[model samples]
Target chain A: MSVTYLEAIREAQTKLLREDERVFIYGQDIAGKFGGAFKATKGLAEKFPGRVLNTPISEDAMIGTAIGAALEGMRPIVEMQFADFSSIALNQILNNAGTHYYRTNVPVPITVRLPSGGTKGSGPFHSQSMEGLYSHYPGVVVMTPATVEDAYTMLIDAVAIDDPVVYCEHKYLYYHLKADALPKESFPVGKARIVRPGRDLTIVTYSAMVHEALAVAGELQRDGFEIEVVDLRTVKPLDTQTVLASVARTGRLLAVGEAFPWGGVTAEVISRVTTEGFQLLDAAPARINAKDTPIPYHPNLWSEHRPNRKSIATKARQILQE
Target chain B: MLQTAQRGKKSKKTAPEKPASKKGQVHERYVEAFRWMLTARILEDKLASLYRGGMIVGGVYLGRGQEAVSAACGIFLKKGDVFGPLIRDQAGRSAFGEPLLDVVRTYLGSVKGPMRGRDGNIHRGRPRENELAMISHLGAMIPVMVGKLLAKRMKGEKEFVGLTTLGEGGMQTGASHEGLNIAAVEQVPLVVVVTNNHWAYSTPNEREFACANLVDRAIGYGYEGHKIDGTDLNQCLEVIETAVKRARAGRPPQLVVAEVLRLAGHGEHDDASYVPQEMKAQPFAQDPVARTEKYILENGLLDEDKLKQMRAEIAKQVDEAVATAQQEDPPYPREEDWRSMSTDELIDKPSF
Candidate 1:
């Protein structure tokens, strides 16, 4: 049976809950019958009865409690209904949990699952991808899983880590992305995977944008252009060496992400490439991100809001020509 | 949702039945509470001097008049209960078993301290032992306390309880409202003590709230709210003990709004000239420590010589702890060791 990205997330949580007595899921409407807002925690709550709890509509409290539970030795997986709504709990997630381990050496083994990226008219409030915002914090590990297997594995890994983790799961790839069975082994945390290899230009991306980059690479193959793709599984401990090495091979780089065009992961990728791998670049390293505006609510405007295969391909072709 | 507005009886000297044990008996607990209150007062006074003398960094927030509330809550809390201490809770921290020397070291920002020089002043706690440190965001800790209690219950310790302290000002925030509501809905064993110390930094109680009674808000969350005269040590202790008993029995969350005064400025920095004269006069006159001392002296609970000796010993201990802490080096984790110290696993050298 083919395992969809969303199903793989459920399976990973199931495995973690089954294996560790301390693993529990806490979020809004994630209890027995309601499952979750996105069904990411559907049947698992029924399977692990008492472990999965339905919380009140208090994101701030949900995260704070998760930090408290983590401090008390329970590995809590807190699900934010939407990535945008996660901002309500930013105080707890950023200051309390993020600074806990560094200040006290007491690990806060908590994972906040933020269903990220734009999905049709999910609007500015529900469609934000905050990987960059979370990654900026010191004690937090920000994971942006692109594939079905990575989604499953990275989540399990997030629970095992002592520091707080922001698992930014893209909403658009919930069912669109699939694979033949979940893999038993996968890439280690913080390592970028080169999904496709070429000698002309390296396309560095993660989450939903990784697929777009791959598609762009495929389209460029017809024109005798070879484009390499690197999927950054985690954003905080960014895989700078592999990215630099990719830049070295291709002599051109284009970083892409669905987040805003501010000081995001894409900017970080290009910044590191230009700073450390300056000589390797045949041209200046470039990046394409969502427009510097609030994620629009209209379908057409929202579609135009984030990076797509068309925009990515155009950006890649420009960088290759340079 | 019982919502009676019961002002605590006026502070009067009463000799209750003294029990056995050095710290568990009624009179003993009262004596210890007074000592803790004095210690917190004296300790903050020293810290304030240190800050002024350039021996300490960051600010010093004193518990001054709210000692009875903190001591009562701390003493009533049983073993295994997690407590989130506020700036005005040094007495509670002491009653919860945090040593004076450790507290001094934390204030001094010593390298060997619990925070390892990462933080200073009141933002220090021993989470592994269930004594949570306060974050600067005041109301945010209530839910965290609820979370700890919920986790304890989930782990099969059904009897465990969680407690936290916040000012009346923090009650106005969304976090405090959400935390109490969730605690009620989840039926967690948690008690939130609102030390309504009449000011939120420079803002006073008049400017902060318009509610008829602060404690009455608990009724809206489907729980009884108790308003106690915080300066009355005996009343504060009795009310907190009752709340603890109710929480341990799996009741909904309870709010104990204790009306107290902040004798010192918000920190050692402010002169508190903004406080209205009459409002400050009443609570200052009813200082918890003085009330406890009067009861002890009038009721013949402890002799004058022993009380005087106890004060001298406490003063000496504080001086020594400060000296020892001052000598210790501040924590400075080397860059090479950052990986091992911060993360769970040192990454294998990244494959190029």
Candidate 2:
């Protein structure tokens, strides 16, 4: 049976609840039969009993309470119904949880699961990639898992790390992406994976955009140009070494992300390459992101707003010709 | 003490009657709470002097008039219970078992303090001991305390309650609303004490909330509400002690709203010229330290000679803490680790 990305997330929570007494799941409508907004916590609430509990519709309190629980030696997994709503809890998440360890010697081991990125018509409020936003803060590990194996293992790893973690699981890939079975082991978090190897140019991306980059790599293969793809499993600790190595081999770089265009993950990747690996580039490095506007509701407008295979391929072709 | 027109307005809600059987135990608690309140008052006075003398680096906030309520919030908590104290909670912190050295060392920027010179002033806490070092955001600590109680429950621990304090202004925040609702929904044994000191920084009660009283929010949020005149140590001890006991007995979360007027400016920097002199003459403006002292002497809780001895001992302890903290070195930039994340291996080193 094929394990989907969403199923893998459920399995990880199941394993955590079974093994660790300190681990508990707290979120809105995630208990009893309601499960969660996306059912990522389905069946587990019954399976774990009191360990998986529902919470009030208070995002600020959700994160603040998780931080408190973490302080009291509990590893809480908080699920934001959508990535967009996490903005309401920024004070608790960024200031309280983010600054707690630095202010005190104690670590806060809380995992905030943000169902991130755009679905076809999820609209401005629901469809947002917040990894870039959360990554800007210190004391938080931002994980944007692109595959089923990484989704399961990275989540488990996120809980083990003694700091706040923002796990940005792409809403679009929840059911669409699948694997043969959950892997016994996976690559360590905060490392990049070379999904496709090439020598002509390197495409650096993460989350749902990894699939788009791979599709562009396949399209460019028929055009007699080799394209490399690097999936940044975790964006904050950002495996810069892997990206630099890819750039050294390919001699060109293009960072792609689904977040808005203004200074996010894509911009950070380009900034690092230009500052450190400037000599590795045959031409100036480039990046592609969603238009600098709120994500639209119409399918056509939404398609144009975010980076996709068609746009990535066109950008790749132009870079190869450069 | 001068009584204003507003003094007897809320007198209808009188102090709970002291039980005849528990008179000695109640008297002993009164003496202990009084000692803590005195220590906090003296320590804050020193801090204020330090701020004025330019020995201290940050703002100095005194729990000048709110000590009666603040001490009561802390004195009732047990070893396992959590206490989240805000800016004006020094008395509560002392009663909750916070070391005076921790307070002095943090203010003096000594590296040996609990904050280790990373955070200074009121943002100091020993979390392992369940004393939450509060962030400056008002009402933010409420949810954190709720979470702590929830964790204890999940661990199958019993009879432990968590308490947190906020000002009249903080009670209006969305964080406070959410935190209160969740505590009731989970039925966690939590006590929230809102000391309405008639001002939040510079904002008055009228600007802070529209409710007749802050305690009015308790019933709507499914809490057992209690209100008291904060200046009366007897009323504060009676009301807060009852709220804590009710929570420990598995009742709904308890809300204790104590009313007092801020006896000093928001901080040492402002002279508080904006406060109307008429409002200052109100009975709620009675200094809790002086009032508690009078209660102890008048009721013979402690004789005058013994009270004097207690005050002298507390002063000596405060002096030693301040001197020791002053002698200690502040954190040096070169020696500072400067790392925020606890997971050391995850930090990226410059590969180039």
Candidate 3:
């Protein structure tokens, strides 16, 4: 079952809808008539009919409906048109969906997919990386897939988790890569994966940053610096041991993110490492992140606003005193 | 189906609901429900006394004026049925076979209480044995419950109908419209019970909703709306049973307006000075529980001599539960220990 990253996700969703009659996929312009703004859910509505629901411009209702359906033993996966629009539904997700289990012990199993991060020039309203807010909320399992395999498997895992999950897909990576047959069964959450191995430094990150870290590591290899990179697939149940162990041997750490450096996953990982991996640190831990501001419209300014592979390489050099 | 759009005035149906239950229901069950109502009333008043003392931690949201509203909606649930209740739904749970002891324990805030004392005052965690969980958020559970009812309907199961309770205060919440609108579209079985006590913590009902009756608000959603005399226990019983029966038949959703009054301050901590003096006297006339007791005596449903024994027995039961709850240790996170379970992600953690 060879497929592109985009098709891999679509295949997983299409197959799930076919196999599990209780599973539903719905949101604004997502049904077959509109085929989603990205065309990932292109033919789902025609195949499933009423099951592939098309929603109005209401995130609150869209999320609330999916939540209701999930509570009644029906598995519902809701796609927010853009990650930025999830603000309207954040109250439901933060106050109700995510916190339902810890507050009331009532299990609400639903998957919320956000076309997250930036590279495309959709402007601030349409293009924003807002995973920090979701990560800030407790009881939510957060996912930012870095590979085609992860893009496919995380959707299945998100549905299987007893708690609600926010599966953030980097929109830039939609047609960027391909892989053969993502393992469809038994994908686990809270587990990080080692994408590359080196001994001088550990590059810890997730989502698009995983690609940037890999590129930075490739350039650093010319300078005889060995970098170990681990992709933290899920941010909430952060895979601390795999990261801490890698940094313990490497003696240096660089956490990268495309989101704002302040209050992002970078800050979270740094705090964790300073506490759990304090002895392993050779130099003070550092993070490379996007400038602390709203993503702008101009292609040049947007390029400057994002933390790229160069930013990772420069930060790694600064930490290593290159 | 009676498809009229008026409130309470149902379209004249040629056939009334007659479920094929030839088992012949007992008369004692209705009497027992009346007894529970009486017990809930007296218990609310007494719980205030306990609140004033150090015996109770959180002040009770005394459902003093809305006792009959609870009684009417809860009486006839069978096994596998679920009720989504709000914070002040003591009478509703009591009607659903929840133990008096557990309710007392929850109110008294004991470690052995439901949800392990994580929820207090206005949340539901205990009484899992009855299949009803407490909805803590404001009208957030409406769509969630309707979705459940939708599932029951789609599967062609008569086993579950979502019984949801909210104060008229939360009626304006968006989830209410979303829940009711979709429930109507899909013809799902759901009963929305709004206890309009006329006060959403000092805001008048007139300020909250445009219509005088909350049931009127349900019309736009294609619901069969009813405005019942919440003070009239008999009327409440008849109307709620009708809604439940209609819901079971997949006749969209029904909105019931139970106009109630608050006999006391909202909670133990809330001062009564905020309430207007004239408003308090108005509901006293329609004091539902008092009216029911008078009717029970006038109708000779219970002997005057037997009433004394029944009151004494119920009083003893409530008092014992409260006493046991108080004597038991405070909740897992109460008193000196505000919360033993604060996650690393801090939101509302208590600090000394």
DockQ of each: 0.53, 0.73, 0.32
- What's the lDDT for all of these models? 0.84, 0.89, 0.74
- CAPRI level of candidate 3: acceptable
lDDT (10s digit) by residue, model 1, range A1-322: 8999999999999999999999999999888777899888898877988999889889999998898788777999999999899999999998888778777778788999999999997888989999999876677889999999999999999998888889999999998999999999978888889999989999999999989888889999999999999998998788898898998999999999999888978888888888777899998788889999999999999888898889888888888788
lDDT of 3 by residue, B132-251 (tens): 454555766676665565555445567577687888888877766665666565566778888888778778777888875667666677777777778877667767887888777656
Top of the candidates by lDDT = 2
Each model's backbone clash number? 0, 0, 1
**Which residue pairs collide in model 3, if any?**
B114-B126
Q: Tell me how candidate 1 scores on lDDT.
A: 0.84
lDDT of 3: 0.74
Residue A268, candidate 1: C-alpha displacement in angstroms: 0.7
Ranking, DockQ, top scorer first = 2, 1, 3
The residue ranges of model 3 lying beyond 4 angstroms of the native Cα positions read A32-35, A46-50, A55-58, A65-68, A103-106, A184-188, B1-32, B126-132, B154-156, B283-285, B326-352
TM-score (chain B) of candidate 2: 0.93
Q: For residues A1-322, write the lDDT of model 2, one tens digit per residue.
A: 9999999999999999999999999998888887999998898888888889888889999998999989888999999999999999999999999899899989899999999999988899999998888888887889999999999999999999999999999999999999999999979878899999999999999999999999889888898989999999999888889999999999999999999988889998998888888899998888999998999999999999999889898888888989
Sort by TM-score, top down from the best: 2, 1, 3
- Residue B286, model 2, lDDT: 88
**TM-score of each candidate?**
0.95, 0.96, 0.88
